[model samples]
Target: MQRWPVLLFLAWVCFLFFAGIGLFMSGFLLTRIELASSSSCSDPLVPPPWERQSLPPGSCWAPQRFAKAVLVIIDALSFEFAHFNPAKTSPLPYENKLSFLHRLATSQPRHARLYRFRADPPTATMQRIKGLTTGSLPTFIDVGSNFATYAIQEDNLAVRQAGRVVFMGDDTWEGLFPKKFFRSYFFPSFNVKDLHTVDDGILQHLYPTGKHGEWDVLIAHFLGVDHCGHKHGPDHPEMAKKLTQMNEMLRSLVDHLGNDTLLLVAGDHGMTETGDHGGDSEKEVNLCCCVLSKFLIPPLPLQEPEAVPQVNLVPTVALLLGVPIPYSNIGEVMAELFSGDGDAVSAALQQLSVYHINAKQVRPTVGLPIELEKRRNVFLSTDLFCLVQVGWGHDVIFVGSLH
Candidate 1:
């Protein structure tokens, strides 16, 4: 009888042990894996540009396009708000609110390109920001960590340009970069009820800091549109007022921009019909990205805007500023930013070379089978970057040569 009792207790212990192991394994498997590779400006693996033969390994291949760049984040500025639908006889309050953007894109087609910047869901701000900077996709599990802002572990755009970076608005940047900026102005973004505090805070520092010319890259994140969306749905009168304010602010910012500067405006994510996000609904994922500069000329004239993956921004921004692309970036340089007018072949070659470096950086971690790796290596070694012409066809024409 006593031995039976002992056997039962042993069985119970074994059950608990196995259950604990299973539980730990389940939790470990469920957690999202973060990429940990870091890249420096001097990495020898990245090849020098063909024309820029004297360039050292990992040295910036393309000449810097702009002396300065301004990145503006208008949270929750959806496609509906950015695009003015002509077909609707009576438009919603949120519709046609950003007249300035549409007008500029139409009037100065070469200078301004508006795109439907599609984000990987869950479209919460933090995850979107991660995707924007790191060029990595987020798992659904990341949505839960929206409130808990952790420092970015991977190589990011901000860190690569550290000390030369200036940041304003959205304290989330403060959390993610943490002393990475040369100058920073941050406001609490948690209070959804108050809209002006963050916007006004950005307004106070935005122009003055830009005029100071102390930084290379200026990042300003505006939360008014998003907060208004959260407090009152996009259809409300208040939403119209908020968007109008944004429109005016953008106009003023453009006036302040010199020819030497490039202006990049993007919505981190869009809101649903009810003005909530963090889901994969069409409205929530379709946001706006506008790149404007006196020098910029797109491959196509501004007609209806096209959709682009959000990750592409990282390489585009990096190359525009003459910086090394982040080591783990999986995105290709967006072709629309370059003009194919007289230099289509050169542009294609530059893009292919950039892709080759990006491929070299990312391939080791993907763990392809040995045979596949050999084939990929052979293809890369043989200047098969030219093969992109055959594979991409019409797409390569728009990618303006960097050399």
Candidate 2:
């Protein structure tokens, strides 16, 4: 063959090799979501305090924090959907359609507040819920568990509070909690093409069930917001309509709520601009965690919403209701929710500090003050020890999930 012909053949081979590599990289980027690893259940450093069936004293862990709790999860509800309703003075180009949640969070006496609850990557729904309910970090394994047939064996308060806990919405909970609900209207969460099925079923049943007034806990998870995201991207017209519908339903529920009831609304994970998730970008991981009630949570947090770990809710919920923190929990107690009798708040903080120290069995838990708890339950503090023990990449990893 002529020299020119040979040279062209060689160039073609090189192009194929590089193209093959590029395709492989793209596939890996699109499908794999793992960002961190976790300690095995048998990891020796894990103390008994962080295991199943163990109890750590919580300052607000008392008997019956409220008469009831209602958790309404509007899947894929991003921070912008619920937290911001730019006033006329604001400069964003689009005409701002106000959400009912905005009204509730900023009402004269403030019937509710919205927080920027952070979510970890893999932003898959199941992994997010596992993190939310168990107060546990998402392991790289959760990527598999998101589709695996395995049952979640971790301690979950929603399951523990089973007898009177009513559930309606995504069937994902059916798989995760498996027979833990008292009365349930489990609707299919798949089928993004037919968006209304799950939401309609949930809406039809939710109000009637609430009217019955026979449960201590009511959990209603809406799938429409997420289905819209998957089908039409974040900027779809249906997105706003779905959010508006959710706000109306929730507002109605709050209007009828008795003095002792608390309503919590949150997104399991946020969607990317293209309406897909499983990444660590802000739009994909920042969602809203809102609380509503007839009475004010004293010493309300900042007037504007603040960001906090999604895991923090586990301990916060446990403390609010006087339930024990899950044995394997790593969540911090959220302090801004409750107004203070300084001493009581102090005691709760101390409880969390002690629990943190004992759970990891490593020196002081990272980010906690050394003087906060004097308990010498486990390992000594060291820079490397803290990072390795947390499994969570940094001091801050989690916020709210769409669940």
Candidate 3:
């Protein structure tokens, strides 16, 4: 009886052992299959040499040299929307006190430059962000496939901002730059009816990011302004509240940022007077772009207040952070921001144009020589920087207003 029990126990052990081996083999095979399927012809991690083009001599991405950056994107912020001059808009004394953004831009040791940015319409959030980040023109096809998920195959500035990049707010960026950030917090962009939650949700992470000091780039995309624009027009009661929140947050961010870190704030696109977009009306296409850095020379409105194309920022930010311009970029670099050697600034622009031509990415009106000429002009000018005129490409009455 004892021998029979022992034999039964031995049989059970053998069964368990076989089951374990089978599980291990199955797992091993699945992993191999998964790896095979996921593998790409060109690994983004280790791209081809041609794809990794060199920047100009001194313009390579070195966050160590420039310190890290904090990009605050306030969606649908128009020229008047962010205006805090007290001369314009209502509610008089109460609003301007909270509106340090007004003082920040206009004050001495001025860290801000407010510009009327000309955005490409279909000025939808995705399209604007694509232009802002990739420095590429998003076409009719992009608008047609706005909802579709597309992997970013072209060289992007994110590759330069790759390590330790933290993103919060506006889930749209995740789709725009999938698998890119080290840590991210994405909230629903569609929930416009419930206005405050998305902005508030992103607010929690803001100071903590400043405290930790680990992230090389901290991107905070506030959706409150856009949500307010959608749910209630620019003049709605809630809009004031939202602006107050943004103002407070901006002050906090300024306090928290290291001397090395640059603070860049801009709208993805502007809202119309009636609070809607996707048209070329001055209010809709015209938005504000502001950059604050101790390294920057004072006298806000950097260049006598002219309209710059939204795509221009892609190379501007990349150059500041020591990254190559996105390969497909057609916009000219904002060389005026740098007080460095004009030769190096011009060289960076030339390199960017050359790379675009080599990669065959220049499109429509802007060509390599046209881009290089602007660079050369900026290079040659004694005082005034060269200005490359921007071309327009949007239907006048493109979309029905949200109103």
Candidate 4:
């Protein structure tokens, strides 16, 4: 054989051998990490196993009871922003000020509850939305390049259970849920020049026939805040103006809908000083949860409040809509929020306990296997982070900082 040909053959062999080894290592690490991450909490706060609590046998739509639920999620609205005002009395130096947001924060029917959890690790729009819609965190470690595919594959279980789910926002909003499962009302986030136009579109859809009885669940996400935050930092004048605008938009919805609707206002994640997110940075991922409605939203109370964890949103919403929760759901319904006697509350709690813990194995301690699994694969790659921007506008580049 010629010398050059022999050398080329040797190089090819070496490349194949190394590539094979690398792939095998990656797969092994992933499996090991997944296993380690599966440890059940020893003495886990398992809700009591399931007991049947039937709603009074009657029509689904009653005058006193809500026939529908509307969840309005404001992407990137931080709890810090919701509670703190740097320019409390002073006017912000921006043309499109967030006066509406400030007014809503101060004047709207509001509930503030301490959400107990570190900010979501996959600190991006789509991943957090997935967390809100489905009770599950992103499955992959790194933010995947093909996030839309992953999100649909994972599916938003909560949205699927609703009678009718109308999602109105940027195309990214459409990517978060499976297309086949839900009827989506999509709009180009980039096309609309005005935020109120988007809001109007949502209002029109909700009242297509000038009636609110159509959709069982209406989720409207306003992307301007997050959009502005990415271009300018969250604390920037431009961002503040947009926040105020969004706040006003929300207020408009509340004014139109009145007290009968439960309005949930939340930010998927916050931005950092650099106007970037995708790590577990405390500031980057912290969320703002503001519930404006006659009903008690999580962390808030109709009466004496109890400390429920942040994960409770999934089951709580599910129970209220009278939907059957999946076996994988881990959160419990906050029974204490309903206005009723002690016996009624106890029954609700008991019913919630049964729903949360049935068919799930209880692990008292964080098992070594589970911990190892999380440390290795779950935390190693950036698939989960990639999922955050699955249907987002920006190009996702892994800077190798899943530290």
Model 3 TM-score on a 0 to 1 scale: 0.67
Off by over 4 Å in 3: 1-65, 89-98, 143-148, 159-162, 298-305, 340-403
Q: Which scores higher on lDDT, 1 or 2?
A: 1
How close is each model in CA RMSD to the real structure?
8.8, 8.9, 18.1, 9.2
The list of candidate 2 runs beyond 4 A from truth reads: 1-63, 88-98, 108-110, 140-148, 161-163, 301-306, 341-403
Worst 10-residue lDDT window for candidate 1 reads 377-386
TM-score of each: 0.78, 0.70, 0.67, 0.63
Candidate closest to the true structure, highest lDDT: 1
lDDT of 4: 0.50
The positional error of residue 117 in candidate 4, measured at the CA in angstroms, is 7.0
Q: lDDT per residue, candidate 3, 1-403, as tens digits?
A: 5999999999999999998877654432211000001111121322233335543444443222355878889998876766666675555322343366667666734456666687866678876776676676654333222345554444456544334788899988888778888889998888887777779888888898876758878888999888888888877778888888888898888887787788888888888766788766888888877777766542322246367888878766776665555655656655456533346555455444433432332332332355332331111222222223342222121121111
The prediction achieving the highest TM-score against the true structure is 1
Q: Between 2 and 4, whose TM-score is larger? A: 2
> Per-residue lDDT for 265-338 in model 1, tens only?
99999998888999879999899998888776655734543577787788778777767666545566675464
lDDT (Cα atoms) of all candidates against the true structure: 0.72, 0.64, 0.63, 0.50
Give residue 96's lDDT in candidate 3 (0 to 100). Answer: 46
Worst 10 residues of 4 by lDDT: 386-395
